[model samples]
Target: MTAIDTPNGMAEGTLDGSMAEFFKAQTRSSAPVMVNVRTLKRFPTAGCARLEATLIQDGVPTQQGSAIPFVIRYEINLCRDGRPPTEGIDLDAASRVLPR
Candidate 1:
């Protein structure tokens, strides 16, 4: 099982399996409607492996239009075996997707 280490605490299991705990700990208001999960890159060091991914969430809506879902952008990092310690796992950064 994959372990999700958040600033609040840690959750152990696959993403789907840990949905309840994740929402309780990380989100506010509504639950995530969609998660566009994609890996950006991978780094393998001596003792641990590092993974970078781009996550987009479609859940909370914009103030202007409630019907249109707000797209949230996030960059996440996952560390294996906790080697470096500097680079930890979980939601690293989050921001609203700007319009074009």
Candidate 2:
């Protein structure tokens, strides 16, 4: 139930997106052709967790379209007990990103 959107870590990039949301406690989220993200594990002293995901430009993009997939990584800082897995991500009118 991990939530994923944009590329987590990258320098000088842009998210041509409109709006989205994610839960802090949510993990193991996925998407069919959007992007794949998930949490590996947790630690006691860790206020932040690790998420691994991939973003791909699937075909569904043009009249006669072709696209390729991309790989991205995320190191998110989430508060414990903040947002549960079944909770709804409010997006705040945007998407959840993990770029550094």
- List clash counts for every candidate, in order: 0, 10
Judge candidate 2 against the unseen true structure and give its global Cα lDDT, from 0 to 1: 0.37
Query: Which candidate number would show the highest TM-score if scored against the true structure?
Result: 1
User: Across residues 1-100, which tens digit of lDDT does each residue of candidate 2 receive?
Assistant: 2232223422232223332123211211222334555554443443334445444332223234543333445554343455433224566533456333
Q: For model 1, how does the per-residue alpha-carbon lDDT over 34-92 read when each residue is reduced to its tens digit?
A: 44443334444422333332333335445664534434455455455643334342324
Let me know the TM-score candidate 2 reaches against the reference structure.
0.31
lDDT of each: 0.39, 0.37
Error of 2 at 43 (Å): 2.2
Task: Name the 10 consecutive residues with the lowest summed lDDT in model 2.
Answer: 19-28
Which candidate achieves the best lDDT against the true structure? 1
- What TM-score would each prediction reach against the true structure? 0.35, 0.31
RMSD of each: 12.3, 14.1
